[model samples]
Target chain A: MAEVNNVVEALKFMALGMGVVFLFLYILVVLVKVQAALIAKYFPENTPKIPTTPVGNTVEDENRRVAAIIAAVSEFRKNKS
Target chain B: MKLKQIFISLLFAMIALTSMSQATGQDATAPVVAEVSTEKKAYEPKTIAELATSFWQTTGINAIFDVNDGETTSEPKGHAYEREMTWFESSLGRIMMILIVFLLFYLAIAKNFEPLLLIPIAFGGLLANIPLAGMGGEHGMLGIIYNMGIANEFFPLLIFMGVGAMTDFGPLLANPKTALLGGAAQFGIFGSLVGAVMIGFDLQSASAISIIGGADGPTSIFIANRLAPDMLGAIAVAAYSYMALVPVIQPPIMRALTSKAERVIVMKTTRQVHRLEKLIFPIVVLVLSILVLPESTPLIGAFAFGNFAKESGVVDRLSDTMQNALINIVTIFLGLGVGSKLAADKFLVLETMGIMIIGLIAFSAGTAAGVIMAKIMNRFSKEPINPLIGAAGVSAVPMSARVVSKVGSEEKPGNVLLMHAMGPNVAGVIGSAVAAGVLLSIFK
Candidate 1:
């Protein structure tokens, strides 16, 4: 009878302890999920903004560069003469 | 003629008075002088031979030999074995303990079994049993260290702080359900508590001894110091020993609990945890711990504080200090402090035997419980949870996690479970702390 009582007592404590741990962990799970959801909804990940125009050399840019170089060279020759 | 006669008379009178005064003084000193002379005659000065005998006694050589300073300085009847019989009487137990400490040294050095702790503990044990060394007694160095660290729970908490700084809780955060495995594994603690109580230990002692199942050495030391200080050495040894043996102990039980299919069930890789989530996790745990079990706040709070420091990105220096310098310093002292308790008289007791047996049971039960719980969880869950990862819930940290991975990889060569096992591995840490808190609350 005494041994049985000790076992019963142990079981009671075990149940309460395990229950409390489960309850606390379950709450943690819920809060973590909610936090993830809320953060995902309100503060989405920031994607880097990409420019639409081509970054490589284009025909217009090449023509402008040639024009500027020719005008500077002719001006320099006129000043020298 | 008159002057000469007066002078002669005065001289005669002076000589008589001097003589009378001398006689009176001698009468007063006679008794005292006689007593002094009698005492002096009674005490004879020791000769060179007698002096040698006294020196041998001081050097403890008298234990094996007897010396005499008689007329011829003859040898006494005392033989090597007969003189210090008491000293040699229990040489067997002491020698055995010394051998045991040497074995501990071998385990630590060759096998690399928790060397950080075992080395100092083994050395301390060696120093403790030296005949007449008094290292484990009051006023001794080891004794002072024990009083400072282990006796008051200072060293263990500091170690916890360091452990917290080193731990990355992102794994547990990534998969919250694995936290239940940590909780489930604590069954080993409570179950063993019952076993201990049934074995005739008191409730408090049973609680302390059973916590060895939790597989956290500092927590074991902390709880033992609080509830059953007398059993601290045994419980600590058992806890760390089992933790070191996790690779050996957990696998067999883990293999038995789950089938090969369950073992190879591939768990999805956990999502990346945000820095914000990592920062908030410790604070939330600290607050919730206080609310649930205030008794556990010291341990949980220190651990959480360490984790927050590490994750906050502002105190990198402090975090580094906690992880390396501070933790290393505390570990040395904590190891020595625990070793001080391994005195022959204190450690070689009936309770020590019970603690060893119960400790193994607690660890095995914990591993079994964790794996069994994972199997049950898999029954309802859509995601197939690998049962091997569940054994990591015994809280041996990365060691248990590694074991889980190794065992799983054995079944399916490409199936790696290390990352998945880490989830329950970290959870087991928190779960053990919570379980310790529960025990402390009930006992307190």
Candidate 2:
């Protein structure tokens, strides 16, 4: 019976409580979003690029791997013959 | 003259002999002294029947046996059977509770449902129910542990510290709008509040119980301890059980609220958060929380302090200790203390059933609110937000986030929503704590 009497008050609390939480979070979101945008604008992210070797050196490594594979295959054919 | 002297000596000798004879006659008859004796009583062993009766009486099995008195004893008046025993010592409810404890154990072990917490709580429930064990009494070990931590709100706050230490705010920083999803989920708390009050629970108890919707166990325990200590056990259990069941409970509501295409929507990768943003995040939140709701300081302060310590990078040892040793120890004692409240007299009631029903409603309502809030957000934004990620806004942490990922993957195999889901997941933690503060502002 007492709870029935207080239902109106509890509903009010529910509205107010949910409203406050939403308001607080909305403010927090705006603050964080603004801060993030500002930070990104002022300090653009800088990722260091990996150093590339000369094209001749890069080709030399790949050619060596290819040569090793070819030589293993030829040796196998000779042994079979 | 010689004859007269001999006659006198003979007469004197005769007189001496007679005197000696009379003295010997008097000494011959000695007086008698009476002797006192003590007799031992005979021992009589009790009959076998009598011994059995005594055993049953001593062991408190008489309540079950309907033995009111000794052999010739009749049942107590106003009852068909024995009625003198306390409900605590003997009741059918105790058996029902034992079965419930076993169910919890099965859920913890077989179902892999929050095993770290459920296992201890189930064992504690088992300990609390054993007849004559007094484990849940004021002087019992459980009672001491409860007083040491749970009663004073120490263990839950420490757990918040651990949670703060482990949490990374980078995802939330990358997508700040998801905080609204967190806020929307708090609808569960308020919705359950109305339900409880309508169901006849007092405002204080309803507030304590409704916080279960927030999906944060520590905050629930904290509020329950403050406003409704009597219902703390049921509230804590309901809060954790629903949290464990989040994977099962949230998906249907989430699916019902969102379209399949929305589930398949892939979110943009979160922006790379900078160190300065990470350091300032906890401080800003802490300051705002304290300024708005000082009653929330104990919880929010400990959480922010822990986050600051972790983000500072200068206190590796302290952060490690809070995240590991300190939290684990607190968890064990806290689980046991909560389980102590499962005594039949305390938990086997109409109110417990109400809390269980209301708590489920709270979780479902929160999940729906978050998903729906996301769909509404999509209406105004150019970027399509996967409404599935909003379901993670109930603060069940990685579990809720994983559920989001699972649902999304089921819709589209290559979709990865786990990191994106974490934005609202962590925000839900903050939102729930804030809701707790709002409730505290009223009830405290």
TM-score per model over all chains: 0.78, 0.79
- In candidate 2, chain A reaches a TM of 0.51
Q: What's the TM for chain B in candidate 2?
A: 0.84
Candidate 1: which pairs clash?
A: none
Candidate 1 chain B — worst ten consecutive residues by lDDT sum?
Answer: B69-78
lDDT, model 1, position B87: 30
Highest TM-score: give the candidate number: 2
Model 2 has a DockQ score of 0.22
Best by DockQ, which number?
Answer: 2
True contacts kept of each: 0.33, 0.54
Tens digit per residue, CA lDDT, model 2, B291-323: 788888888888998888888989989988888
Give the alpha-carbon lDDT of every model.
Answer: 0.76, 0.79
Quote the B-chain TM-score, candidate 1.
0.82
